[model samples]
Target: MKISSRFTVAVHVLSLISLNKNVVSTSEWIAESVNTNPVVIRRVMGKLKKAGLLDIRRGLGGATLQRNLADITLLDVYKAVEVVEDGELFQMHENPNPNCPVGANIQDVLELILFRAQDAMEVVLKEITMEELVKVLSKKIG
Candidate 1:
């Protein structure tokens, strides 16, 4: 299953936003790091801003972290990027062979498994913070 780009960008965005020291970061730079469209970055930033994880300024301005990275979990970033808590993460294929009994029931079983997996993943994500990720990334990049 493919995690959305929203999750990727939000993680990076939160990490960089956490690095500022009495300074704001431009969306352009954020987008550049993301290697994506500025419009897309702005849209994601808007959601993060609304979630109180970030602060945005208008007119040649930039964004700043409104909350501490330690206080912002990966799950929080996922939420900011609009990743629903539903079982869609598994992306169960719709066309299970209807002829077989197991096939008839596979969807239900898969959905239940997906839900549980999602829950487990959410817990795991909550255990890590943007600050921790930034530290790891810094070490790796350094």
Candidate 2:
């Protein structure tokens, strides 16, 4: 399954906010930093807002981080922006050949593997916080 960049962009948006803790971050500014369109930033920001991760004032104002960076996890950002059917991170091929033995068992095997992979990913994501991200960014700039 192809993962969307919206998850990364969402993290970028939050990290920018965390980096500039003293100032409200406009979508345009964030978009410029992320090298994307402001509209795209706003759309992702909207999802984060809905997820209670951010606060965006209407028109002429900017966005603010609602929670401490240390309190937010990558998995939280993933959930905020990922639009998945049935909230699945991994997807199995649809309509595997029922006539073939490998095809018949492929999905079952895939499901077990995918479930473990998804769980592992979530565990890693949950272990990471935005605070850790900011420290890494600081190292890069300095």
Candidate 3:
């Protein structure tokens, strides 16, 4: 199964806040940019706030980054949004037939590989910070 959209949306929200530091990034305003409902933005914003990535204001005050963009990484956003449970990114089908050689051995062989894959991905994510991403975004928009 694919990872949830919440991760990307969180990144988008963070990027928007970084780019438009002067603008009040209300849930509705962020929703407009993401082409989604304000409720979705609010929900994602709530998670981001809980993760200490964002500081959401009460009422109409809107939201802002809690930490510098340079301090945030894609992995930070990934975990913040809870796209997948810790160490459970690639889930295997439950109850492989013990009688079958392939079924019995599949999980054993695949688990380590999947974990390594996930770890590798996290490594890449950790290397790239939000500030780096925003720089790419800025170049693209110009």
Candidate 4:
């Protein structure tokens, strides 16, 4: 029921890139900012690149955004690194008690609720762009 931290890390990496748009973002520097290993940052960067959210260069080079911050959304980042099965953002428990009416019915009810919740979440995430995040961070740092 837990989402991987890859999504957050990807966002953090992208944010760093956005903030330092004039300069290439090295994995080492991004890793330092994320408090993670360079290898981890590289892995997430691969995903972002594949998603067309980033442009990565070879050795001695670094990463950059493929598009403006306003063009990217958290859901785009989520889809890039999320490893969920069946493409579901949420999962339901397996094997609800068939004999129990409540247990049997609960799964269906939960599915509907969880689906709606995920939809609502994506809607909000869609509303938020990387531009908004960078602005917020810039204000805090300055």
Candidate 5:
């Protein structure tokens, strides 16, 4: 299964806020850009706020970035949105037959490989800051 869309939506929200600093980025406005419901934007914003990545205002005050784009890595957004449980990106099938040799051993052997793969993906994400992504996005928009 693919990672949750929450991660990408969070990235989109932050990018929009950073790029459009002059405008007050309400949930509705961001939702329009993301083509989703305002509730979805609100939910994602709440997670980002809890992670110290965003400062969400009450009522019409709208939201703002708590940290600079350069300071926030893609991994930060990924974790803030909680796309997956910690070290549990790739879940093994439940109730594999313990009586069968391969079934019993499969999870044990595969867990490490999956963890390594997730770690590698995280490393790449950590290296790419939101600033780097917004720069590319800005270039495309222009």
Candidate 6:
């Protein structure tokens, strides 16, 4: 199961911001860290800005964290990506076999399972904060 790229980018960018604080980080630099296009970085950064996690400036300007690192968690970062709706991860099937009892109930069962799983994941994510993420980055980068 692959997570969204936007979530990954947000974590990375926010981790940098958590470490550097008010120092504006360029999209180019973030792109380099992720090894992706700056355009993609900008697009994701825009979403983060809208979520109030970051402040984006134009021109040669860049971005910085808008809130305190201790106040930001992995759950907040992931929520910025979007809510984890039921069956969002599993995806409901439209063409279930009407002839089979199992097929008729698969969608409902899967939906419940997926919802629970997402909730469990969110619980774990909520425990991780930007401060923890920055510490991990520091170990890897410095």
Best by lDDT: 5
- Tell me the tens digit of each residue's lDDT in model 4 across 21-63: 7877999989998999999999999988998999998976799
Error of 2 at 69 (Å): 0.7
Q: What is the C-alpha lDDT of each candidate?
A: 0.82, 0.88, 0.92, 0.86, 0.94, 0.80
TM-score of each: 0.78, 0.85, 0.90, 0.84, 0.91, 0.81
Model 5, stretches more than 4 Å misplaced?
Answer: none
Q: Would you list the clashing residue pairs of candidate 1?
A: none
In order of listing, the candidates' clash counts read 0, 0, 0, 0, 0, 0
User: What is the C-alpha lDDT profile of model 1 across 51-139, one tens digit per residue?
Assistant: 89988889868988888778999888887787764436666778888999988899998888878988898899999998899999989
Clashes of 3: 0
**Model 1, position 25: C-alpha lDDT score:** 77
lDDT by residue for model 5 (1-142), tens:
7899999999999999998999999999999999999999999999999999999889666899999899999999999998898758887899899999999899989998998998999999999999999999999999
Model 3 stretches astray by more than 4 angstroms = 99-105
Position 22, candidate 5: lDDT: 98
| Model 5 Cα shift for residue 86 (angstroms) | 2.9
Roughly what TM-score does model 5 have, to 2 decimal places?
0.91
In model 4, which runs have C-alpha deviations exceeding 4 angstroms? 83-87, 97-106
Tens-digit lDDT track of model 3 for 1-142? 6889998999999999899988899988999999999999999999999999999889667898999999999999999999888758887999999999999999989998998999999999999999999999999999
Ranking by lDDT: 5, 3, 2, 4, 1, 6
Which 10 consecutive positions of candidate 4 have the poorest summed lDDT?
Answer: 82-91
TM-score of 3: 0.90
Write model 2 residue lDDT over 6-84, tens digit each, in one string: 9989998998888886776999889999999999999999999999999998886789989999999998888888655
